[model samples]
Each structure stands twice: as C-alpha cells, then as structure tokens.
Target: MPALKINVHFGGGAELLFDKIKKREVELPAVDKYLPECEKKGWTIRELLVWIKENLLRERPELFLQGESVRPGILVLINDTDWELYGELDYELQPSDTITFISTLHGG
Candidate 1:
C-alpha cells in the first residue's frame, strides 16, 4: 500500500497544543490500514483527526478535539480553502495537500 504525504499546520494558538510546532509533513499509511472500519477508499479529515490525536497531539486533547471533529472556534482549511467548502470532516484528503488549523479562541 502506498502512503499519502500531506502537510499539517497549526497557528493562532493552535500550535501551542502541538508542542509549539507550526508545521508538519506527515506520511499517512494506506486508508484501510489505519481506518479499517471506514467504508470509503480515501482518507477523510475525520480519520485524519484521529490519527493526529494519536500520533501528533502530546496533551490536552479536549482543547483540540470534540468527538470526531475539532472543537468550536477552530478554523480548518484544506489546501488554503475552508474545510466547510469541502464537506468539513468528510472531505477526502489528497497527497501533498495542506491542512491547517487555526484557533480563533483566546484568553483575555
């Protein structure tokens, strides 16, 4: 199975949850390998979030995740376009695509 390579970015305080790392290039295994229960052939943002939580997130999972999606106030962009434009969590991921997460919430 071929791996899919994609870029991941965190910003607007979202990076804090990722150990202050602003960017990462991740190589995901075959969709069936990581998401055996999924009926789809391609990887979706929903599955990607699970992978992120397991592989990249170091702490405070609640701050970044809510169920299978991101918490409120977190803006998700795929390939520079809003994820909502691509069906949000159901959007299929493509190789070399860039996925970015920016938090709009801030402490006073």
Candidate 2:
C-alpha cells in the first residue's frame, strides 16, 4: 500500500487534535487504508464533525462556530484540494495520494 501524508493545522487551539492523530491515538491511513481508520474512529463524511467536537468545541462550549460547525479550522486536503470539496472523508482516493490537514488561523 502507498503511504499517505496526513497534515493538520489548528485555527487556534487545534494542535491538540493533530497531536492526537500523530500519536496514533487517532488512527488513519492511506486512501486505500482509510476505511479501517474511519471505522475505528466511528467516522463518516456526514459525521466528520466529530473531529472538531472531540478536539475543540467540547472543551470550550463558549466557542463561536464558523458558518458551519465543522472540524475546527483544520482543512483536510487530498493532495491540494480541500477534502470537503472532493467528497469529504468519503473522497475516493488511490494509493500514492497525499492527505493534508491545516488550520486557517492561529494565536498571536
């Protein structure tokens, strides 16, 4: 199987989520290997918002959500395009595809 590069960025306090995934507490794999991670994480494209809930808003109920209550500011991209635009996590990917996640903003 091809290796997938997962990137993550936290708008303000989202590094925690990234760290969790990096440490393997949040399991993910290459495109071909995605199903197992999704199943293990109890995730689906519709339920992808959990990544934000478990990592962000739950901690700060006072947080203001953007236009959509989503998985923080972390933008998940397959190669370059936003994963959300492609098909979210359900986006069909092949081996050798790269996945990146990044935050839109950060603290001063």
Candidate 3:
C-alpha cells in the first residue's frame, strides 16, 4: 500500500494543543492500518481526525474534537479552501494536500 503525503497545520491557538509545532508533513499508511472499518476506498478527513488524535495530538483532545469531528469553533481548510465546500469530514484526501485547522474560540 502506498502512503499519502499531506501537510497539516494549526493556528490561532490551536497549535498549543498540538505541542505548538504549527505544521507537519505526514504520510498516511494504508486505510486498513488506521481506519479498518471504513467503507470508502480512500482516506477522508473523518479518518484523518482519528489518526491525529492517536498519533499527533499531545494534550487537551477536547479542545480539538467533539464526537467524531472538530469542535464547532474550529475552522478547517483543505488546500486553502474551506472544508465545507468539499463535504467536510467526507472530503477525500489527496496526496500533497494541505489541511489547516484554525481555532476561533478565545479566552477573556
């Protein structure tokens, strides 16, 4: 199985939850390795979230996720475009794609 190379980014305080690294270049393994139950043939944003929580997230998972998706205040962009325009979690990932997460919530 070939790996998919993609860039992941965090900003607007979201990077704090990810060890303040801000950006990462990742290679996703075969679908069966991370998302065995997936019915789809390719990797999707839905599966990527799970992978992140397991492999990349360092702390405060709640601040980044809600149920199987991102918390409401977080903005997700795929290759510089809003993820909503591409089907949100169902968006299939492509090689070299850039996925960015920006937190909209703030403290007083």
Candidate 4:
C-alpha cells in the first residue's frame, strides 16, 4: 500500500498544545489505516484526532480533545472546508489533504 501524505495545521491556541508547532506534513501508514478498533472505516478526522493525540500532541492534550473529538469551541477544517459540512468526524481522509485545527476557546 502507498503512504498517504497530508498536511496538518494548528492555530488559535491549538499550537500551544502541540509544542507551538503550527504546521506538519505527515505520511500516515496506508495499511489498516482505519481499523485501529475493529470495523473497516477508512481514515477519518475522528480517527485522525486519536492519531494526533497519540503521535503529535506534545502537552496539555486535554485542551485539544474532549471525548472522541475536539473540545467545544474548536473548529476543524478539512481541505479548506468545514468538517461539519463533510460529515464531521466521518469524513474520510485523502492523500495530500490539508487538515486544520483552530481553537475558538481563548482569552483576551
């Protein structure tokens, strides 16, 4: 299987949780890309969130995750579109796609 390369970005205080790194280009393993549990669902943002927690998050993960998704007040964008428009967590990932996480929870 070929590797799936994609870009991930964090902003709006989300970077604080990722060691202040805002952009990352990662190549996710193609084999069993979505079967971390049991069912065969292609890689989605939901799974990607878990993957990020395990692989990318550097600190204060609780600030980024709530349950299986991003905490409330955070916005997620996939391929320049709102994730909610594309089924939110169920949106299957594609090669070279760009995923962005921006936290709306902030203080002045």
Worst 10 residues of 2 by lDDT: 22-31
**Please, what are the lDDT tens digits per residue for candidate 3 over residues 16-106?**
9988999999999988766777667778999999999999999999999999999999999999999999999999999999999999999
Model 3 TM-score, 2 decimals: 0.95
After TM-score superposition, what is the CA distance of residue 22 in candidate 2 from its true location, in Å?
9.9
lDDT (0 to 1) per candidate: 0.93, 0.46, 0.93, 0.84
Candidate 2, 1-108: lDDT as tens digits: 444333333434444444434322233344235444444332343333444455433354323244344446556666677776877756544434554545565676
Assess candidate 1 and give its TM-score to the true structure: 0.96
lDDT of 1 by residue, 1-108 (tens): 468999999999999988999999999999888888877888889989999999999889999999889999999999999998999988989989999999999999
The count of backbone overlaps in candidate 4 is: 0
lDDT of 3: 0.93
Model 1: CA > 4 A from native? none
How far is 46's C-alpha from truth in model 2 (Å)?
A: 9.1
TM-score result, candidate 4: 0.89
Tell me the lDDT of candidate 4. 0.84
Candidate 3: stretches off by over 4 Å: none
